[model samples]
Target: MAIITVMVFILIGIFELTPLIKKGDIKGFAINLALLLCSCTVLTLKSLQISVPSPLKPIENLIKAIIE
Candidate 1:
């Protein structure tokens, strides 16, 4: 199931990247690829039941401390 999900993401990424590659948009393609990879990694991890630590926790804590 996780494999299937990752494969689907790969297909979606390929579909999305085709236009940028054809148009010679290097910067846009790079940014899009980076974002797509990051999202796919997160989704794959989640599908595999992996627990990812959130970066926002410290910020939230800081905000709470300031409020108090």
Candidate 2:
């Protein structure tokens, strides 16, 4: 799960940064850098097995209910 989270963050960071880098927008580049840092922090938390409640768990249960 931690690997999955890291991969997702990396993909998102690349997606966000690519356009900014292409446009030569330094501010956007910095913002994306900050986002990358935050994502890394999250990845580190996951690596440490710091469990937390799933933010989407309730939504998932709702979907399951509808499906059932």
Q: What is the TM-score of each candidate against the true structure?
A: 0.86, 0.58
Q: lDDT by residue for model 2 over 1-68, one digit each (tens)? A: 76777787788888888898899998989987897887687676877788756779999999999999
lDDT of 1 by residue, 1-68 (tens): 67988899789878988899999998999999899888888878888999877979999999999999
Which segments of model 2 are wrong by more than 4 Å?
51-68
The backbone clash count of each candidate, in order, is 0, 0
What's the lDDT for residue 13 in model 1?
79
Lowest summed-lDDT stretch of 10 residues in model 1? Answer: 1-10
Residue 36, model 1: Cα distance from true site in angstroms: 0.7
Cα deviation of 43, candidate 1, in Å? 0.9
